[model samples]
Target: MNAPITIDTPRTRISALATDHTALLLDYRLRNRDHLAPSEPARGAEYYTEQAVASRIAQVEAEAEAGSALHLAALDRASGQLVALCSFTNIVRGPFQACHLGFSVDHAHEGSGLMAEVAGAGINYVFDQLRLHRIMAAHMPRNERSAGLLARLGFEREGYARSYLRINGQWEDMVLLSLVDDRPGA
Candidate 1:
């Protein structure tokens, strides 16, 4: 499914993460490692390796096929480099139609609205194509950028959680937010 789903935007090309595309993913991760380390969970050295990325991509592909999750890579078409990534994970169907959203963009692309461009399209795909009712996203309380981005995406503040996640090795508090598909028949 990841290999087949692709969305082309005016400034970027968004495609599902595929195992065969390890080179692009590896390049992106390597380039953004320092830039993304703050908000991301602490990872071992192996996490940055091509073999690790390929293995992760393979897992995502399997999850996509099973209708549980999707990981998308956003590329700057003009520069031909990956600029961002977003994932819809922990997808639950049946009566509980929902998933969690997580994303990161190149440091250079920050404040350029690339994350919004990619994540907005991803949210639409999740709501319309996947028919999920809700998307939950959380960010460190100190990260105003993420808070603003989630607000702009129509994700209302839900609550706060203490030590909600481990980021940069230590436990961190999170400001929870959620966006619900409220369109008619959703």
Candidate 2:
């Protein structure tokens, strides 16, 4: 048998959430629809539909294959259960070497550190593994939990953008946070 793999985020596994994982993702989204509504900041029920989910999977796959972006679904290593979804989108290579982080956790699993674990792993991958210099995440000001998580992960608050995104309907302000890998050795 192959030896068990180990990762920093304790029994947390993140993998491409393709069409194969659509049912799991849809179930979680449906069950926690209300709780997820707040963190979404943008998007709605239509975003969780099977067609949309399949389309997103295709988009992410194409982007990954083209070396443009990376998206992952976080799962419990032991049970192989879906817990959250995260992505690095709007990636700019070369001089920019940066991407934006977006994520959402099942309402039942919030505050369990799973999302944080995923974010930390993504930051490490972007900075060390992919040789990217910076990563950014933005959250609605009222989303205290997300802001806290970003801060705990060493992201510095950059600024707030007015009417950054239309959430549910109204335009919402977003607090931008970033982690820049500017070490001399890097």
Top-TM-score candidate index:
1
> lDDT, candidate 1, residue 133?
99
Over 74-186, each residue of candidate 1 has an lDDT whose tens digit, in order, gives 88999878899999999998898999999999989999888999999999989988899999999998999999899999999999999989899999999999999999999
Worst 10 residues of 2 by lDDT: 1-10
Model 2 over residues 1-186: C-alpha lDDT tens digits?
012212346857776656687777777777778887755546655977988877877887888777677777777777777788788888888888889999888777789887888878877777776688889989999888998999999999999999998786778899999999988877
lDDT of each: 0.90, 0.79
Clashing pairs in 1: none
TM-score of each: 0.96, 0.88
Question: Local error of candidate 2 at 109, Å?
Answer: 1.3
Off by over 4 Å in 2: 1-8, 41-46
